[model samples]
Target: MEYARRFPGGARAADLLLCLAITAPLLLPDHDGFAPTGLPLGWMRIAAAPLLALAVLISRRRPVAAAAVPAALGLAASPELHTAVGFAVAQVTLAFLLGHRAADRPPALWLFAGVLGAGGLALLAAPDADFEDGGTLVANVLLVFVLPWLAGQGMRQRAELDRAGWQLAERLERERHLVVHQARLRERARIATDMHDSLGHDLALIAVRAGGLKVAADTSPQGREAAEELRRSAAAAARRLHEVIQVLREGDETAPLRPAGESVAVLVHNAKASGIPVTLDDLLSDGDALPPMTERAIFRVVQEALTNAAKHAEGAPITVTMSRDGRNAVVTVTNDAPAVGTTPPVPPQNANGHGLIGLDERVRQAGGTLHAHPTAKGFTVTAHLPLSAGAPATPPRAASTTREHAATTRRTARRRALHTIGLPTAGITVLLLFMALNDHGTDSSLLEKHKYNELRIGESQQVVEDRLPARQLRPEHRPARPNGADECRYYGTDPDSFTPAYQLCFTAGRLSHKDKVVLSRVG
Candidate 1:
């Protein structure tokens, strides 16, 4: 009720601890009698059982002073045993605590069947009240009336299963922090749309070839070799804008495969310096010792398939390849054919360049697989990867063959870590010298007579076959020895004719196929 008037001293100390837990179970000793019924206990039934348990602890903050002071101090109290069991357990705990209070309006089920049908008709109008003791008045109306309505319906179903497991664990931790804050705002809007389409198409082709080399500086030698090829393509687009701002300020949390600044024959001679002819061939030599995330995921799947074949097949030739084998490395490429009547080019859809979705998330973060398609005679791509021993694809570094291949690759990685640490330290030194010679009894005095019968008297399979007679396992029988010519019982015997020994000792072995007869001439 407005949080019970902002907690009136915790609602008067929860109405004096619910009037001392309902008169401390009616001051404990009245097992239904106190001089049969002189009745009125001393201090007026302990001040009418704490004023009928503080009128059912202020029935939800005074439900009409909790129904006229616990039904007129339990119908003027003088009957007996703590005024008929503390006024029928504070009148069924003030009608199940004012039927769980939302500022109460509850009292109707014919007002608890006319107040428990007028206290079961004034308790069968008591003339010394034991009307055939009707099972002690139906066990005092189920212990002072339906055990507090089944303990207030089991504390309202365990407070609605602890408020539905704290609102389903706070809605699954707010949907896992809203899917990791929408994948870091989609990787910062894909590196700001690939740095605004590779530095706005190389600064608008070096500002239209520096305004046609300042109006043909002293008249065109092919516009000063196309304005010194637009100042060496704007100083190689300022070293690819400082290698894409040091790979977007070093983010893929370290995708560093650092060496080959350029290849696949200098990326098909820089895609024939963007005029797109390409062609390349085999390549490897220290392909950055393999894993710098598998050579930066096959060099961003061949730089986004040669920047989508120079922005969609502009003079296509393409080809490339790269290989390996044991523990794969592939790479492919494809291109060379779609120019005849020009119709193949598609890849330009760019709602923020995750160029072919960041080359399939950099070949699945280097756990490889890239693909791309289209090829009847054009557009391809591909990738593969997976290699590690601190990365390896080495081949062409020739300074004295790169110090004799780095001293034969550090003596073949120190002979594979000394043959994998001398095969498990010689198999744990032959299992600690066969468990220290089977614990001191050298080879076998029946393993020190089964470790002195497992420490004097136990483990009985007949004291382990009388101290292990060669670890006794001989009972599979065939004993008709004195040259009786019928010895073949290694399980399924067939020595000519003991009719598989009366079908395995009289069929106990479940004889099948006309019940056993594999006896072939062996007399």
Candidate 2:
């Protein structure tokens, strides 16, 4: 059944042949148009074959119904069908079809056994013309009925195994997707927690300091009102940020809080009001309408750059630039070095160096990149934010991608090596073993020359072996001369014999000459 799904065209052709085999016997003419029982096959009997074949064709989706109907009809018509070869073939084919198409094995096996028992009894009651004895009847039933059933059961088991393998693969793929999704959610929650805990505390302190300065006795009325507004806004922003972090922690789909559509122009104005000399070059007319997250990221980058410049390089002039290049919104901020011979302010020792790092993470989460580096004049920070919706925020590291590709290539090479080299090497070894086992020339007894006196030059190696008792010879230690002739040698058992060894030289399977070896030791 699995094979049919894999190759539909072939399965359809096979099904066509099965249906024809089952039905053709019904339409076939009996010998001389008469049954052996001297009974004519009426229309009813002839009609039964096609109906049974139709039932078997429908059995692919309904195996039980097909099996029962055909068995009942065949039994009613068994006496007339016993002499027809096609009837036996049809019965066997129906049994195989039923077993192969069964939805469950246990019930199918019981039904199959019952059908076999019924078929055996019917054959015993009305034996075929050729089967004059009970023994032949039983043999026919076993050969025709049981064997096909076993083959169909084998097919059913194989189909079930293939189905199980397919289901397992699908389950594993789903689990892999779920695991990756969970990892991304965890990373987002970690980022949210860090921003709320660290940056939110810093902003809260700024609000309190501004509130204290607003009520001082020396403050002017206009300045006091501005300070009061800044304090309230900062405090409200901090509270809203806490709510956003809580939503992220609970994995809610609610949108996080964002700044009130802040623009680069507003950020530049704030930096100048803070007493840091700054200039702006705005080349983007649509900068204010950027996506909420992208605009927030840009505003934060500018603010962090101005703050870093004011703290470390006071009195240095800073320049901010904004423009749209292709689909990216680009921003760069640079500050000049302090005047010559002017001492720069020293940074505090308690600084954790997380300002630039946090800014970089924010830009990346908005599907952008950030670069901060020192220049010959002073320092510069630049960022690029993508405008496309749903683009991946975090780009994969190049090193990791390369390593994954290398691993995949190694696995492919291993499989190729097994098919290209391992299979051929195994095939050659098997062939060599087959040749060695069947070769008569490898026999040890054929290498011995016991009757060397009867051997003569120009005789074939086969003739020499026949005349001499070729026994107790070693194939590995065969002698060879420089002129390229193969030699076989045998040592004499007698220690005092004048001729201690006999040697026979053969050139191209024909005996060429013989020699005697005399062993003598030099003292």
Candidate 3:
């Protein structure tokens, strides 16, 4: 907005008026009245005001040039007056602006100092009727020159601080943008990995069939059948690849939906079509409603798991399971583990490292967990995704309610006896052990003792209890210490929760004088 752009205009205008006010007295005719001793103090008044006004007006636009003109005028008019006080102020302001504009202009400062010294000598040679003593002259010099120089120095320091703050804010914004960009790139790499794993085998099988068809273009019925199947499978694989590329290319939240009838079942069919053995459990009914994120997450996990299995398992049978209860969906994939000491196929040179890691991140971001490990009999990947909404409402539980009421009556006496004696003792033990072990050990200043003290405490305190309290033991007195020498260890914590537990550790030691540390964090 125009209003925002000109927000500082009023302040700048006020400064211009202040600059003019300082020189307003100079405009009065014959204001520089001479004393009875024939000494003119009024001449000093005449030159000081106008020079300051000129310097102030152009200070921002052309600071050095603005300051220089007034300084030159004052120096030329120096003999008539003992001091061009305005010129001294202008010179100091010029020096400050010059240093800030191009910080290495040292010679400019020295040159100004030499000129000041020469001017002071010339003033001392003049026949002056005032300021007789060295103390008086020095006091005058300090008031006229030193104060403005100091003011200019303070302004320059403030400007530098402002610039530093702006740079820091800009750097943080750039870092945030870079992190989002990297996440997007990692997503693309994951899609590529999945495509390579799933489609590569089908394409390779098609290539084999194509070779056979080319060799037996004559009357061979078996060869013709193989060639036709190869063409159909290749078309299907190409269609799936095109779908994935479309998703990657646009990256829009509202891009086109997947083609009708494309699903994990179709993917399994494709794998089987390529002559790989695969078994699938269709646990969810066709009528089940699913969130897009959950569906995409499920698809990626299965794709990656199956691809990895086919690549390394040497044609081992793959088992895929999908189950959806009212409020949760689970996917489990398992395949025979490779024989002992069998090396995995080295991923091609263009393979990105985001395959499994991306799948894990996607599942976690959707409030689920993905687990992958080598079982005794096979390799397995299992994911449990929570439903976005709670479970569907149950029908009116008239019969269930009557049965529950009868069960509750039968168990009331036993439940009462158990809680009356068992719960409090278990709660007390849990409280005591938690207070003793968790409080001091989790404190930032005392965290370094964790390896020894915490481990010992956990071993000593582990015990059986019938019931336990639901409340968490609070570490009330532990202070947060980030930059203290007494802090013994850093406790990595949940980034979302700012509270981090630390262990006892010393402050980071300083480097020796022989070592160098760059001031910039870039290093």
Ranked candidates, highest TM-score first: 2, 3, 1
lDDT of 1 by residue, 1-523 (tens): 3333445567667666666766665564432112223335455467776576657666766644564455444434432212343455565666555544423234434344444455556556767756544444445445543465456556656656755865676676666556544443443344434444456566777867776675764857777767777777776776676666555543443332222355456656765875777776676644556754566567657766877776667676777788876686888887766577877566666533446555555555456666678867777888777776343322211223334544576679769978999899999989976864432221122123223324232233343345332321123443433232222121122211122421211112221111123333222
lDDT score for candidate 1 against the true structure: 0.52
Candidate 3, residues 393-479, lDDT tens digits: the string is: 222212233335445754795588688868998899899768634432332222122233323211212120111112211334443
Clash count for each candidate, listed in order shown: 10, 2, 13
Report the lDDT tens digits of candidate 2 across residue range 1-523. 6445545577676667677767766664432212333234465456666677677567778776766565555445443234342356666776676667764666656664665566556656653533443344455445555577668878888868856865675676666546545544544554576567656878899898889889899999998999899999889989998887887674442333234444678778877898889999887655546774576678778978988898878899999998999998899999999878778788654222456755776777889898999999999999998766555687623323334554586679779989999999999989976854323222322323445566778999888766653343343434444266776545442322313456667788988868765434211
For candidate 3, give the lDDT.
0.54
Candidate No. with top TM-score: 2
Of the candidates shown, which would achieve the greatest lDDT relative to the real structure? 2
Which regions of candidate 3 are displaced past 4 Å?
Answer: 1-7, 10-15, 24-50, 57-123, 126-132, 157-179, 192-293, 296-523
Question: Candidate 1, which segments miss by more than 4 Å at Cα?
Answer: 1-10, 13-38, 41-46, 49-86, 89-91, 94-131, 141-146, 149-153, 207-523
